[model samples]
Target: MPDLNPQTVAALLPATCRKVFVAYSGGLDSTVLLDLCVGLPAFAGKIVAVYVDHGLQAESAGWGEHCRRQAERLGVDFELLTVDARASNGESPEAAAREARYRALRQLLAVDDVILLAQHREDQMETLLLQLFRGAGVSGLAGMPIASAFGRGQLLRPLLEVAKVDIQRYAQTHGLHWVEDPSNQSSDFDRNYLRNEILPVLKQRWPALDKTVARSAKHCGDAAQMIEAWAEQTLPTVFDPTDGSFNIADLSAITATQLNCLLRYWLRRMGLKPPSQAVLQTLVEQLVCGRCDATAQVCIQGSIIRKYREKLYCIPEQCLQKEVQTNPWIQEQERIILSNGYVLSRSIASAGLSKNLWNNAEVTVEPRRGGEKLKLPGRAGHHFLKKLYQEAGVPPWERDIRPLIYLDGRLAAVAGLWVAEWAWLSEADGCYQLDWRASESM
Candidate 1:
């Protein structure tokens, strides 16, 4: 069995880690982890035990108290964070609790701090099996990572390579006491069912199942990392980070498998979960191979992918809501944050709206209400805003929400698009340039 000791954990920690935050849940794994951390000389005064009270169990408060006492006995600082772990629509209770717990933990982290979790080899095996049953790809089959960036710091799993039996043996040898969570016995949760019923039978036939499965997971993780490296190198060539869109023409040379990999990479980079294999295939067929004129879209969990002008845009679902109402813009402020999270800022430029005119006039930001017109800087006559948008290749959805900068009740500029001929400055000393920054959701 692998050693479940302080040296093993110390070896896994980053050299630059300033403070170590132990996720002490008053359970067998966490209690053993806390004891091991307490035995480390390098982390003497820099250790903290944080007990997250997910509020799922009735005895959660008691468990927090137990964790606090354990921390106190171990000569480490203690913290108790309570979170609402109620399940939302279509969400499982286990998933809701896990999300709420980690959400609270993420907020608790500081820069350069490392949060240590107690997941071990058995947990890794369970994760791999669960992912396999759910039809997960290589990333999921790789199971939990030993270390990953979390919040403002790092999250480390020191015991991931060590088996649970080893941890139990260490706890027994040290006479460690820990609370047993009743939820673990329940077969309602998929993970619990696998652990309590399926794994026991499987383990009886294969004594070193955890170790063997962990090895397989490591192999998968290696492959996943290689794939991720390739995606990182190829993503910049096809994706525009500013708009969260990818050029379809650039992907013409890539195979369908490569396209799916790039698409999954892009979604994860944008903080959205990748779609299932079936959904991904559908997205590929409709977004890339559908009629050029047809506005093809595929909706995933928290985002929607829409195709426009040979580009696939991954738009957050929340950004599809109605545009915010017209609001006044204070020129003196130089910047304004829209209710929908978009930002409009004014800057000095060589040729834009006349600086003198902008400074002397009142400016307001308005959402497009249609029938607006503007004269191009070098064009002869005025043109409809719709015509300008069409000519500029602005997506139809964006046209309705693009901020219309009005100076004293007249349209002076279309934010980030065009400045009216009347407000245009060619050889002026300095001019006002209005820039619109779309929110992440947008």
Candidate 2:
């Protein structure tokens, strides 16, 4: 008896939203969502139906055409986005497809553009059940949020409180036509299996299965938010934003439960998925309690958590690659983006390399090679880069990867760390500062 009408849907939308994008798949749920959005007077002329074609099915192109036609008939704009959804080794096809689809959708969002999804109460119940089966934590058990940040915009599930039966009723009452996806009927997918087989049996006995499960998920969501808030407050105390690392001593002072929450929150803040509980336990044990000199590291997906110099650093796997490649830097260029995801940029400063010398000389950037030496401006003589790095407390992993700036085949600067004595400029001299910017994944 739940109403799936325009007024109810409109109440869920943000007042400051600039545009509404319906994730149309030419399916029943999305079709009903599109219809509701189109019926809203405030959303008129501001609606776009975005059809993401994963190209997993032979009929995908045809489905895109059907969605375009439907949007056109409804007087809404339509966009077709195609993506590669091929699964990697040991990866789930459904997960790959979803990742690809959302990646494409995220790229299409402009600032303040709200994207609407059609996942209803039943879908939320299914998500909670699946997460529980996997022994997930509070955050995973929370299922999908009604609204969250997506790209530069917001993603909303206005129908999250409505039942799937109500959505079907609305579609039927409006005489809406939608394309049937053949894959939804197949039991090969776990979600489909749950929806077609397990859920029906469970719902028959519970009757209010969706409502009850959704209520539980909401409670879990509230608890997860509280934990996240605690983590946010504690992060600045132990985390070093300058180097993207955590102090081992400070981390050891907190309780084990607090540490776990902080680690998960840190990973989420970096846009990386948190590892399984066992993996997280291993990460903490090895990285924190292991031998000081021993190389302790844990890898999850393509990111690595490593311990070095009493600090814990989360870096991309690619950053550990040791390739000695030299890149020429043209005099006119202000920035050089490296293959390792680091950026070397130049800016005007009072005390750096002399601008006149830099402009006339040949410049090249390379990763550290052994036995490199540089003399500090105020120091007596040339010192080995190794000794300088040790004195400056630079980590071993960073030493090999930090940009080494050369001028006329001589090491002139160690990128933001030190400028060679010969190249150092006085305050009166016009200078250009060289900076090393680490990638977000680092």
Candidate 3:
């Protein structure tokens, strides 16, 4: 009976949203949804259909063309994006395709743009069951929300509560045509197997299975929101903004279940996926009970939760790789980009390295090599790089990746942190400052 309620859809969308982008695949759900959007007076002359081609199937290109033709028939704008959805290490092909599709869509959207996806009650029920089997917490059991923040924009699922049979009826009444993906029939994929072999059997046993499961999901969502509110109130008391790490000792005061909830809520707020139960337990054990000097790390699908110096940090696994590069300095070059995507720039300043000295030296930049030493401007003698990093409060993981600027075979500066005593200009000589900007990916 829901059948993509326009009143409910209107309430979910922002008043300022004039443009609507439908993630259309020329499939039944999307085709029906697109037709509904095209009929809405509020979205007149402002609807577009976007089809992403993952290039996994041989017929993907033909499907994209079909979607384009369908959009044209509906008198709406259309776009097709092609992406290589090849799975990386430790990533499944389905995950790769989904991520790639979202990434592509995100690039096409502006900050205020809204994208609509067509996933119905059956889809929601299946998601809940999948999360339950994986031993997920309240958040996962809640399934998908009606609306959520997408990359730099927003996403709306107007059909989330609508029944699949109602959508099929709408399509049939409208005399609509749509593509049927062959992959959906395969039992190799987990979702496909559940849809074909599991859900039907369950439905036979409980005729009202979809409605009851959806009701339970709604209850879980309400509880998850409460937990999120609690996390927002508690995070400030235990988080240290100065160094961007959590206070492990303070966190240890709470029960393990409370700790898990707090951690999952915090991670979700930060736009990062929380680790699985087993992985999160290991991480918490390392943080709450491990020795002060001991370092521990738990790698999840694409991220790593690390414990160091009695504080916890979450870093992407890709960032842990050593990205080192050496490049000869040019006098006129304003900025140098490192292998890790960090940017280093030279600027004239009142108090920095001597401009004349630097100009005369054969300058180069490289990542930190062991056994390096630097003399502070006010310190008595040169100190080991390891000791300097510790004194400066730099994490051990960041030390080796930071840039080292050398002037005529001697270390002149350590990024923007410090300039060597020998490189300090006299009162008469002009000075120059080095500015380093970390990668936006971090």
Give the per-residue lDDT digits (tens) of candidate 2, residues 1-442: 4467887679888877889999999999999999999999877889999999998899999999999999999999999999999999998999999999999999988998999999999999999999999999899999999999999998999999999889888888999999999999999998999999999999889999999999999999999999888889998887888877877775547898898888887777666887789988898888877776536688887888888878888888787765488899998799987887877899998999988888889999978879998999988988999999999988888888888988999889999899999999976549988898666556
Model 3: what TM-score? 0.86
In Å, residue 116's CA in model 3 sits off its true spot by 1.0
Q: Provide the clashing-pair count of each candidate structure.
A: 0, 0, 0
Tens digits of per-residue lDDT, candidate 3, 1-442, equal 5444456467666878757889999999999889888877777787889999999999999999999999999899999899889999988787899999999988877877899999989999999999999898888999999999887789999988888898898899889999999999998888899999999999999988888899999999999999888888988776766544666766556877888777776666444777677777777676657766435666665666666666776665655666566788898898987766667898778888889888899999987779999998988988999999998777788787778889998999998889999898655438888987555665
Best by lDDT: 2
Q: Which residue runs does candidate 3 get wrong by more than 4 Å?
A: 1-8, 57-62, 86-93, 241-243, 265-272, 294-296, 300-307, 315-326, 366-373, 425-430
For residues 46-141, write the lDDT of model 1, one tens digit per residue.
Answer: 899999988777899999999988888889999899899999999999899899989999998889899999999999999999999998888999
**Candidate 1 vs candidate 2, TM-score winner:** 1
Each prediction's TM-score against the native? 0.95, 0.94, 0.86
The window of 10 residues in a row where model 3 has the poorest summed lDDT is 1-10
Full-model lDDT, candidate 3: 0.83
Error of 1 at 229 (Å): 1.1
Q: Which residue pairs in candidate 3 have backbone atoms (N, alpha carbon, C) closer than 3 angstroms, thus clashing?
A: none
Off by over 4 Å in 1: 322-324, 426-429, 440-442
